[model samples]
Target: MAPFPYLAWVAASTVLVPFASRSETAKLARADVPRSRAREKLGFATGQRDATQPLVWFHAASVGESLSVLALITRIGAALPDTQFLITSGTATSADLIARRMPPRCQHQFAPLDAPGPLRRFLKHWCPDAAIFVESELWPQMLRRTHASGARMALVNARLSTDSVKRWQQMPATARYMLDVFDLILTQNDAMAETIVSLGAPPARVARGINLKSMADPLPVDHAALAEAQTALRNRPVWIASSTHQGEEQSVLKAHQRLLRRWPDLCLILAPRHPARGQEVADLITEAGMSHSRRSAGDAPAGQVFLADTLGELGTWYALSDIVFLGGSLRPIGGHNPFEVAHSGATVLSGTHVTNFAETFSGMEELGAARFVSDAADLAEKVEALFSDTQGREMACAAALEFAQQQTDKLDEIAARLITTLELSA
Candidate 1:
């Protein structure tokens, strides 16, 4: 029997799911999400599943979570040639990106809502042999129904905050019941492993695993675009502030102002985390009195500031410079992935609030591949030091590249572990 809280949740969701699904579908459609894909959340699948071949279902919450597992899925597919994969994520952004870069034999879909009707139709159609839930996506009904269907399940790259741990600890029976659905729970580090265990996951089932984000395939670089940008810059010293959030852009613009004093022709490629804010960010650059060009407008990197307000071109921007400042850390939004920057052969500079990728940043810092900046002044200072010291900058880039390379070597090991734990092998 399930706990009272779980039972109550099921009862309420059963009554409210229809109305909720309609409301959500309308909201997503208004956001320009295609009506066809939005309806998938209401238990409609866009494709057929092959019942003869074993299928592995991976559910991730958003873009980062979905992309992190692509390499692992490739490795697993190589080992089990007869296996097909189904990846489900909740966001349209993730859906579009995954469609472009999906691994062979894999299909992407919008995850069904965690209600009886959606789950029933989803499970009945897909009939996944094994399910892998990534990070903190512990949808109660999804887990319960999948487990009840006799499909082996594992939670990979698991992480939880102190507050979440406290909340789970307060409902110990519910926590245990939910966690027991997983045959294995692989956490990002030892601390996360301990945290999950404390939440009632079987100690034997919990193990420390590498951060999957570290193993993401390098972002695809458009060679023609890279060449054109490099030629336009004509040897100007460049640094990029990639994935900048709202509050962080002001500091980045200030730092760019400071850099202009020493290196008059230095170009700053500012890519915001959300490109929809291009006009807003352009206003900030203008207020800072910097001549700027917008990438979405097809303007070249001709100004002191280049606003890269486009999607899927981060690789080309990273290739423009060796000094990269990753944002999202300046505020409490956690941090963007540094491995992507490192993989592009650049030195990483970030702020101090990177709780999401704490272990990842610690490793890079230890390798002398990444540095932490406090404010605009500190950011300018660090960027200046890297620009002036050629040897030091090269060493940092080399160290970062080395660190990025080391992560892929662990993918096969992780893939094998998942295979054994989930019994996904033919």
Candidate 2:
């Protein structure tokens, strides 16, 4: 790894992190309500660890990465009787979700802020035997501190988007130093492996692993809630515009407006990529001159655009939708997990930015089991087309189910490798 830029970038990030921590403290007061107890929100009980224990640490960024870690942790614990894992994430939402799902022996925490002092304090206290980082969480201080504590590190199920690679290239030295810190860089596909090597992850350490993201169990949704939602909107042709970013919603709303003129009873559910933006979405709907109601608000009318401003229920929306237009792509954020929506047996529509989940969506498209919309208008057209063609819709759904059946093996392969690498069976 080269020097100057890498040093500066780390120095700058090290400086900025404290400010970022301040912002987290600020956000907690505004939303989480109990501002003072934010640090205790890490999810682990407050106290020193018992001296006699085997410990490994896993760090993830947010809900998606953390949930994937949970899948791996389950495998680790069933095999290793003595090992206890320390899991950490950055957000309260992630902390709460992990509070619900982490393994019996594992503990979750807010992963103290990524500055030298806090990370050093955390490393000294935890003294993990091995450290694992889930996709895209390349915090320098955490990596450096973990390595210094004599814990070997691995970047598992790694990914590099085309855009990210370009940015990293401009600061080759910093990218390389960060890349080299990992003892191994396991990728989900050859392209990612190639990109990792190009970014200076040791070529020998880079290998293809199953994308843990691809392996997630279709999220569990509440059957009672599904039945209730179905009853609430009886026989309406429902489609979801999921994980919608900013500009995409306007197009989706326009398309929704157009579709209503024809289908008249068409129901649309817009689940924004960020729940905090729910009010903004409601405003956008009102701006479009459409009646709307938020799930957060009361008395949802049958004829309004429903803003599903909640977390984790996205699966339920997909399960209920006749079609799903995955949001990020139609605008520009490169797309989200179309596989999740596809697994729900909903016809899937995506825009071009699926660089993140490249291989997964490609397989779905290869099966002719999902559609790639040119944009929001294309999403509307495809949904309208599928609605008029029940036979075609059923065919796509069946193929999607078949495509999903093939992914079960991939999950097992990843979980097995993670268990072996962590030496959990000992």
Model 2 lDDT tens row, 1-426: 337854565677677865776777787666663654455332223435655777878888887788777767766666676888888877778877777666868887677776666666677677887888988888666676677778877888887666878988897777877777776778878878888888877888788886776666676687876777888889788878889898888989988998998988788988998888998898999999888767766423256588888777777777787588887887557688776776787767888888777788899999978778786577778888988899989888888888887987666666566666655456
Candidate 1 worst ten-residue window by lDDT: 22-31
How big is the positional error of residue 284 in model 1, measured in Å on the Cα after superposition? 0.6
Count backbone clashes in candidate 2.
3
Q: Which pairs of residues have clashing backbones in candidate 2?
A: 42-109, 42-110, 334-353
Give candidate 1's error at residue 395 in angstroms. Answer: 1.1
TM-score quality measure for candidate 1: 0.97
> Which is the leading candidate under lDDT?
1
* Clash pairs, model 1 backbone: none
